[model samples]
Target: MTLIEIMLVLGLIAMLSIGSLQGWREHQQRARLEQQAQMLRIYLSGLQAQSYQYNLSHLLWTIVGKSGCVGSGIKPADCASAGDSLFKPTAPDITVGVYSEKTMGFYGLRNMAQAGHITLTNAAGTIRVILSARGRIRLCSEGKSIAGMAVC
Candidate 1:
């Protein structure tokens, strides 16, 4: 091939590789966000199950921030007291928000008075970990569809 033709072919390959790399990065970020959301869901579900098994009322409180802890307590102060807590520190390129009810108590054989949700957001999309009043935990994507998850 001529020198000019060879340069054109190389440019095309470079462009394609750059595009593929960008797409791969986005996919990886979305996967990380989804993983964080799923982890929070599992933690909350386990807490609920624990409450039922022990037949005791358990309180859950979370702060909305890049780094925060989900702790068992009637007050935010209890989060620092420590005992059965999930502490998340600066998840990779993701922002987290807890909406509606910040403090919830799970009592055996009693239904929640209101529902709450935690939102995990990245450039790729947003996922909500919702806890229903009936004590159901579910994940739904918002604004963008995520693989293996339902759209909100």
Candidate 2:
């Protein structure tokens, strides 16, 4: 093959590889966000189960940012927030938001309380994991909705 032809083929291959790498990176980021959201949901459900087993009324799941250890410690003390007596230990960089009803009571399995949501966000996108008080978990994208689904 001519030198020019060889160079052209190499350039095309490089372009294709770059494109593939970009696509793969995007997919990996999306998967990470989904996994983070799912992890938060699991922690929230576990907290609820603990509340039920212990019959504690003041237990709450709080979302701690990178700066604060507050509710994410062994005991829900030394935190800045007032109602955040419970927190899930998460990575230092991730921002997970937890939502629950504002009341003092143990959340039993049969309570059927208002739905709670956990939001996981990154540079790529955001994923919201919805947890019903009745222990139903659903996944939804932020600011987008489908038929018979909730948007966060």
Each candidate structure's TM-score, on Cα atoms with residue i matched to residue i, is 0.85, 0.66
Clashes of each: 0, 0
Candidate 2 per-residue C-alpha lDDT over 31-149 given as tens digits, one digit per residue, 9 for 90 to 100 = 66666666665665665566567654324444445433323223444455434444433444446554545521235545443455656666546666676656576788776442223
86 Cα displacement, candidate 2 (Å): 7.0
Leading candidate by lDDT? 1
Task: Give Cα distance to truth, residue 134, candidate 1, Å.
Answer: 1.4
Which residue runs does candidate 2 get wrong by more than 4 Å?
61-93, 98-106, 112-114, 144-152
Q: Model 1, residue 152: displacement in angstroms?
A: 1.7
Give the Å shift of residue 59 in candidate 1.
1.9
Q: Global lDDT of each model?
A: 0.74, 0.56
Native-referenced Cα lDDT, model 2: 0.56
